[model samples]
Target: MAASLAAKVHYLDITGEIDVFEHASSLDGEARQANILLCPGVGFDVIPTDCLALALKQALPDATSLCLGFESHSLKSPGTAKTTVEGIGQGTKIRREATIRTEPMGVRARRIDFGQGERLAVAFPWGDVSTAYKTTGIPSITVYVAVTSSFRLAMLAANLLAPILRLPLVRRRMLASAGTAVGPDTEARREAPTYLWGEVRNESGEVRTARIRTANGYDVTIHGALAVLRHIMEMRDFDPGFTTPALLCGASLIEELPGSGKIKIR
Candidate 1:
């Protein structure tokens, strides 16, 4: 990205990694100086949720805290599975009072309804915790993923064995056990739709909730990335700095995508 900025070209990526996003954000000045955009997380990882965060913020402009949750039936690609292995011992990440904080795994869990019945969702180091803060300026942020009982048990085991799990050999073994398929098949992609939910609460106790349904993760990643690129190509003027998809194109970015459903509020 630095090279791209130095080359005076717009830099964009579909990364959902928090550390990478943070690093990109640190280059805001350089990006602006070069009149180029340093936008990342233009994928299922943050686009849907980040745009939802902005939507909730608009609905409750004074919201002080935000909670975002997602449930997806999409099968993990090899890359996604490898990412899971890499984070085997990492802690949960949240934004508190505009500051990023890391807490123990499984430290937070809640019931969230993603336009369906309630499900048990646990906090995870989702990229939105960082991007959404930038998009909405919400001080408190938490991102959760719905889990099955067996999956929850696996997380508990991973938490208790963090030290051992952190070993390179162990992570490698886990990765080896995970097959190297690229991702879901075309049929699976058609069958699997992802759901996202979010809530915002102000200091005055007012609250707003919204939900979105979109195509499978991989499909959304592909389309969302292209959509953002197209929008940038169509824009006559865009801010030249580290920015979220919503920040760059408003909350409508997600809705304007090929497979995103309407944002339902309650």
Candidate 2:
């Protein structure tokens, strides 16, 4: 599938100086010591986060990882359910799952402890971890979202809708509707590709953000998952809070996937 896409995509190589800016932000020393949090979206979206975490562990051997599971707005609800970890032998291993509740920004998250050197996996919904950065003290966070081929349009809608969605009444109704609407079959109906956008912060108060899209076909989670790992691998220094995947990783990043084009800088 990847080989097929590699032949079709026309990607442009970003050249010259990549301008990265410094943002004034400080990482809590304690947060730097916290475990990694992986929020793969409900049901099908969960697969990509799991794949990304596994790929990340391979690239950063010393890193400990976990997948998030949620109670309030997940497909597998009301009881403990098992989820498969792809890319492993026979794909049979199951991570012990945990539940997270949906709440307003700045709300304290329930404490979750991890043993030394242990890689854990949990599943949770998007935006649920807004406060995890403070409560859990995680130094970095990578969020994956699937969007239509028209990524710019999707992103615009999200940005425009964010404030409206934040309204308590609206958020509650939306969550309620989504809980009843999404399911495992959701992936089958989704034809768009996946993208990864995340933030990395240092103790000295600098934040770097990145957005990368898959070079593979629509609905292919692994492509976006691998793109996330590549972004983490290539981000050695702080960048302009807004930047493209091509600017950071170069055109070769998409050389293997055909329909995938150069990163669009808006």
Candidate 3:
């Protein structure tokens, strides 16, 4: 982002890193002065959920709490595996009253219906816990993903060994193994689909629920990045400085992706 600002070029990345967003936000003044856009999370990490959050907010302008969940059949890429390793031992994060807070990973669990049957979902430190609040003024936010029984058991074990997992040696070993992983094959990527779910509630108890199904993660990343690039190039005027995918391109951007199904809301 710094280099992009220096060169007076727009910057975009498919990162779910909270620090990256914070750093880019800190440069908002510089980016605005240079008339450059610094947009991030233009992919699977936050695009669908971010848009859903905003849509829910639009449905209930006084919304105060939000919950987002997803179920992805896509295999983890090498980069994603490494990023997971990097987050080892880090507890789950959620937004409370518009502030980021950390808690035990498996502490929160609920049933989520991702436009299909209900499944067990566990809270995690997903990117939207940070980005969603920025997209919508909804204060309380939690992001979750569908989990199998074994995965939930692993989360319990992770909570028990959190301190040990944070050790440099342990993390390095895990990272090494993650680096060796080969991601999904062409057929696997083509067949796998990603499902997203979101709900928002206001003080009056009104609720809005929505869901979206998209192509595999890697495909979404590729197409979303290009779509954002195209939108940026064809724009006459746009928000300068740090922004998010839905904020920059509108919530309809997700629906516009060639490989995504229309968002379903209730």
TM per candidate comes to: 0.97, 0.25, 0.96
lDDT against the true structure, per candidate, is 0.88, 0.30, 0.87
| lDDT value, residue 117 of candidate 1 | 91
Q: RMSD to the native, candidate 2?
A: 18.9
Error of 1 at 142 (Å): 0.2
lDDT of 3 by residue, 42-104 (tens): 888778888888888887889899999999877898899999888767878899978889888
Question: What TM-score does model 1 achieve against the real structure?
Answer: 0.97
Report the poorest 10 consecutive residues by lDDT, candidate 1.
175-184
Q: Rank candidates by lDDT, best first.
A: 1, 3, 2
Evaluated at residue 165, the lDDT of candidate 3 is: 96
**Cα lDDT of model 2 overall?**
0.30
The superposed Cα distance between candidate 1 and the true structure at residue 43, in angstroms, equals 0.8
